[model samples]
Target: MGKLREVEILLNQTQKVRFERAMERLQSLSSTTNNSVIVADSIPFNHDEAFLKGHGTSLVDGELLTTVCGVVNHVDKLVYVRTLRARYKPEVGDIVLLRYSFVAQRQSRWRVDLNSTQDGLLKLSSMNMPDAVQKRNTSVDELNMRNILAEDDVVCAQVGESQRDGSLLARSNKYGKLHKGQLLKVDPYLVRRSNLHFHFIESLGIDLILVRNGFIWVGEHTQSNDPMVVDDEIISSKTRQSILRIGNAIRVLSTLGFTLTLAVIMETFDLSNMENVQIHDMLGSEFHVWSQRGKLKEEHVHSKKNVKALI
Candidate 1:
């Protein structure tokens, strides 16, 4: 952590404040040190004591250290990690937004980059037809798959059952072909997994999809429809500003390494409005520091309350 501070010194005003915010976030996540797994932190096991090392652990100078941060398990003789939030360990029903590339003209499925070890598979059969019928995919569908979603298409879909080749699953067009939105990427760890990933904020006319893979989409709200028909509706000035403001909110939160949640994001947005900070100036050093430092105080107070409850 000292290295972080040293690096912060090298950054300019805005960059320094951003680092401070990220540092604050790291501290906030570390509130529960007993369970919070930090990489390279020593395990409880004794160096002399004989015990089998497991996943996320490495032996350095005869001491076991965790490589990944997650739940620790000691069963019988072997030990391992659990509930790992370090990476996008794909699960069934996870909402994901991925940019896909069609490998070849004859390929029936496009390999999607889901920010995982192995690329996700989106088959032609999983896509919704123009008429919305669930039928067996044909050669014609295979031939026209690129038309529905050509190379470099950003798709918002759900994870289905895993395939035989150990690739993450794909689903229908319930959340398909995201268009006219700003896609922001962050560490998957910062994106907390939630049962409801799609959030449409009526007040701001914004559609917020928090994909488990840390790809956030903030755009003008639109109903899910057939992917065949392109909706090229022009966004009004007011709505465009709303979209950009929400996108900036996301950027600030991500820059601070804060967990991106709907409530917190809205809170930040509301706070900015209350402070009368301009949309473009939210990224200024003053606002970033104030935002994160304020958030840190809240987390501290919340943690203290939890501790008092335990007493």
Candidate 2:
């Protein structure tokens, strides 16, 4: 109550009418809700918190309002607002990778690919750089459209503010770059915009690039102890199926929101499935079928005959 600079009971005609109706209802329910009574004319119609404080009391009008959380003594104090909040609050500000196709020196703006709708723009002047820093980078020749960034090149960036009239902005040269790795894309709808900061991979080689549209990765794969890799690549294909299949399996698990454990399962399944299949039988079948087959197709029979004559 002491927080009030002053108190008033003033009310407009409409509020007076509303107050009357509310008071009538309050007569019966106020005992249970424990709200203070409203004086008809002398007290006026006090809507602000200064005149009313609900320590253990309810308001007659509180029931009538839909959106307001009950009225309080500290209404105007701005207590609930939080500072240092992350920019993208699920509605916006998902970390996005972009490429700058155009940078305008005159307006000091960048034309960036946002992966949806039209491209986004980041203005140099709005980067909030200090004058001293600006002078230091002055030799950089402002910013040419193509010199700083060209088509097809990728950049790691953060989502910035959007205009009410429909424009998007992003920034993040200070954050980090999209280094060498494989690209992984998840369905855009599956990713909560707020979840962008939560992505992490324990492996040194694997990194996730999350965006609203999708994510791209750039990395060499680690070897998995899958027997499928040994049989498919080493014995049959003679390639590093272990690492490649592990990478693919990791990708599928990532799409399903499963973490690294799937990599182990993929390896285990490869070994388990390979034990039952006889590689000798497969090779024998292939040899018999291939050996008995004709060397040439119907169209190639004439060429085969010419070669036979030459031999």
lDDT value for model 1:
0.68
lDDT score for candidate 2 against the true structure: 0.37
Which candidate number has the best lDDT? Answer: 1
lDDT per residue, candidate 1, 105-138, as tens digits? 4377778877876677776766656677778888
Best by TM-score: 1
Q: Where is model 1 more than 4 Å wrong at Cα?
A: 1-40, 44-58, 65-85, 104-106, 163-173, 294-311
Candidate 2 residues lying further than 4 Å off, grouped into runs, are 1-91, 104-107, 125-140, 143-147, 164-176, 182-186, 196-200, 218-311
Worst 10 residues of 2 by lDDT: 302-311
Clashing pairs in 1: none
lDDT of 2 by residue, 194-304 (tens): 443323333323334445544443333224322112122222231233333434543433333222232232332243235442323322333223211312111121221
Q: Rate the local accuracy (lDDT) of all candidates.
A: 0.68, 0.37
